[model samples]
Target: MKKNPQQTIPFNWPHMTGKELFYIAEAHFNGRLAGDGPFTKRCHAWLEERTGCSKALLTHSCTAALEMAALLLDIQPGDEVIMPSYTFVSTANAFVLRGGVPVFVDIREDTLNLDERLIEAAITPRTRAIAPVHYAGVACEMDAIMAIAHRHELKVVEDAAQGVMSTYKGRALGSIGHFGAYSFHETKNVISGEGGALLVNDPASAARAEVIREKGTDRSRFFRGEVDKYTWQEVGSSFLPGELIAAFLWAQFEEADRVTRQRLVSWERYHALLEPFERNGVLRRPIVPEGCVHNGHMYYILLSKDFDRQHLLDEFKRNDISSVFHYVPLHSSPAGLRYGRTHGGALDVTDTQSAALVRLPLWVGLTHAQQDRVVEVVGSLTR
Candidate 1:
């Protein structure tokens, strides 16, 4: 079969385990489509077993999971949560919604993750927590971050939305923090259309985490026969996803290892292909520091200072190759201006990196030939 000359490669293609529809049908046959049903239990168990967190609860999205973290922390108006400016809006928005002030921190140059060294300086008397985002699946320096949090008696929420299956040292990215959140969104390596899970690492907070996920009720305990009746226990919202979403996510969890391996293969190929560009000072490839194992969640290139990122992206469009830029630093956004404050006076690294980075087409079934074409376009346009 001849391919269409104008066919465009998408920036992301959701992976399917072939059992998604089957499981969805099974959920229907079981006649339980509510939240925390059998499939939800299965997914929760799988996450707890794999990540070794004290508890796991599936949420509708990573944003929802983060919101649950905020509620669990009991964030009040005027309370501050420190985080990186170079991250998705949800990382800050979740806390901001709880009447909390998001204190924007700078990210490390190499990993583009929240710089642990600067976290201490951002803390104040009203500081409630530190939210570290694992950028592009590469982990933040959790050991240092945790030590600082411990010293300050503050909470740590790991935004591992892109860090699922990735690890820091020997520990899973999300498992190391007090609360870790995962995303199974269609854009993520593992897909359930739109899904996420919160990993509760602290035993003390597990029960409350469940209650918060269940709209501030003890409904989970009631169903588990732990309570005579479930009632509103605290301030919370409906964060849990329905049974059908869990059923779909269960299939992804079953094949999570395989999907991660395939994505790593693609990610490595991009690394090798982009090496020459990096060496020639045309572009820079991602840097994964030692002890950090990434899940190949994304492959993004940073154009050298002299090169125009938009120009190269336009070239990709002309060649029918889909390429895009990532987040605009949250500190610069309108909401951030209104609801947050920047720490350290200047976020030089975040501003520079966020501007130069561009993500290329990457997915489970992307071909070597297609990758070659991507590199070719990159080289032609940049050189």
Candidate 2:
């Protein structure tokens, strides 16, 4: 009789701690079904404490948080926002929707983040901000990037969608920049089906941010009883996430450290098993810069220059294992090509890296036996 194939493993999935149902029930019982409610408050407090930000406002998605940042920075027509070419479309979409031009920059080969060294060259009189995405939960060179932003008088908005509770030199990834955006989408380490948060570092912008999140109304203050009534004050959009999502997110927060540790163990296991392949030039494992405490959100490998990453992806599927590729170099994407400027630099690293990288299965509930099967299949494909 033929042996049975192992169950199909997912790349990433929502890992519930058995606490979500309780929180959902609590939200239902409280009779507050809208944005500003007790569950939302709890989620906000959890994020503020974890990120050490002055305030945290939950939003419908990371895109909304980024759009809020764009609005707060006063991005307007003809203004330019510099960002990495190897990022999600939303990174540039937020600014582009505000009538600003997204100036694409190349990323460092090691971290796959915006090259801080190349930023100054991209700066111009029309430059308004620098949006650096912390790819794969590895923090970017924040100190260098921050210094450049300070001298150029440009706001820094961290697109930390993959970086939650991650740190660079002891400072939280999102807290280091003027503004930061985090995601709780199902694909991320934390999940609320779809939710995100905007971290406001500058104290002066807190009240305005609150208004912006509330669809340009002073409703947040009104609800706090600071004002008797609410009214629209400035140009803004509906960014606040509903209470049901926040309630689900709060359950994940309750098991924050435990979830992180579980993923870390799996990440380490992959690194150890794959180290020899990296040493022998068969593949390259992730490289976290010094002084960074990553959140174990992703584990990707770079295949040998001659090996086709896409071929391996097909083979993984053939073997009933699931692995995936990432960002398609935003500069080459149709929208980016049409609306964004490339700053006319060599994107050799960005172009090649995007094609060669592949992310393996990673999630809280992934078992060691399942991970071994994945590694075995990948190893066979490479050999």
Candidate 3:
């Protein structure tokens, strides 16, 4: 089979560590294909140790982890959770499912992250938590957000779905909040096909997080031989991934550092390649603030307002490139209008930044030649 030079470069390609199948076979040999098996425990230990969280629990998806966080927060009807509008719906849906309202805040212009400055303004008597999503694996202003949370007696759920292997001021991005949710979706820097984890930073909520993940039971205690039998105790659902998934993830965990390093190399290359276009005002490259270490999970360019973004996208398509836009501001979406409200009257930054943003093809194994072609297409089309 000959390679096609004209074939489109994909936006993402899941990386493998060459040990996935071997681990899966080992799991089968161990006779524990169920959740919380040996492989799952190993993954748990890795997450807890790497992130320095009190407890780490694997879940079927980041959405599940967030739902677990929502449950742990004990969000009641009419309660409010403040977060940015320029994020995945899961950031809001997780709370909406618990009958809580999502108060949408605008994003920061530079980092495209939740505006920690605006969070305090959105706080009200009904505010239960502040969910700051770490966009593009770049950390939000956790110190300020945490201080606000403390002042208002609010919880912080760091939506660090893209923050694995990334840090803020030397601390892991997800570890700074009261709770953190990470995604291991196929498109993420790390993959388990479709998986995630919950980081319980507060010890008081650690035990209940386990219960909520296990369908609201002290079944975790039972498994530890602390109880003779497991039984329903509170509000929870099945959030665990099977041993097969854990086995696959363990292979990725083994190579996590390598994966991050490779991705960073490619990210830096893109940064260098796009410098001229940025100077010419063709587009704005991503901004990584000082003290915030990112995992190179993404590389995006924000086009100027006058430029025709869709025209450039069509050109990329014709040129066999796979550049694409990011999220549509959730505050204006159908579900958002129905289940949430925009704070301070408008999400000006969120709407503008999301519309202009175009994510390039970034993945673990993206070649220099492929990246050149991708950028070449951008320059040809935009210039």
Strongest candidate by lDDT: 3
lDDT of 1 at 42: 94
- How well does candidate 3 match the true structure in TM-score terms? 0.98
The candidate with the higher lDDT, 2 or 3, is: 3
Against the unseen true structure, what C-alpha lDDT does each candidate score?
Answer: 0.91, 0.90, 0.93
Model 3, 1-383: lDDT tens digits are: 74443366888878899999999999999898989999999999999999999999999999999999999999999999999999999999999998999999999999999998999989999999999999999999999999999999999999999999999999998899999999999999989999999999999999999899998999999989999999999989999999999999999999999999999999999999999999988999999999999999999999998788998899888977877998888999999999999999978998889889999999887888999998888887555
Cα deviation of 136, candidate 2, in Å:
0.4
| Candidate 2 local Cα displacement, residue 110, angstroms | 0.7
Query: How far does residue 369 in candidate 1 sit from its true spot (Å)?
Result: 0.7
Question: What is the C-alpha lDDT profile of model 2 across 167-202, one tens digit per residue?
Answer: 999988899999999999998888888999999999
The order of the candidates by lDDT, greatest first, is 3, 1, 2
Q: State residue 224's C-alpha deviation in candidate 3, in Å.
A: 1.1
Q: Estimate candidate 1's alpha-carbon lDDT, on a 0 to 1 scale.
A: 0.91
Model 2: lDDT of residue 87: 95
Give candidate 3's error at residue 242 in angstroms: 0.3
List the pairs of residues colliding in candidate 3.
none
Global CA lDDT computed for model 2: 0.90
Worst 10 residues of 2 by lDDT: 1-10
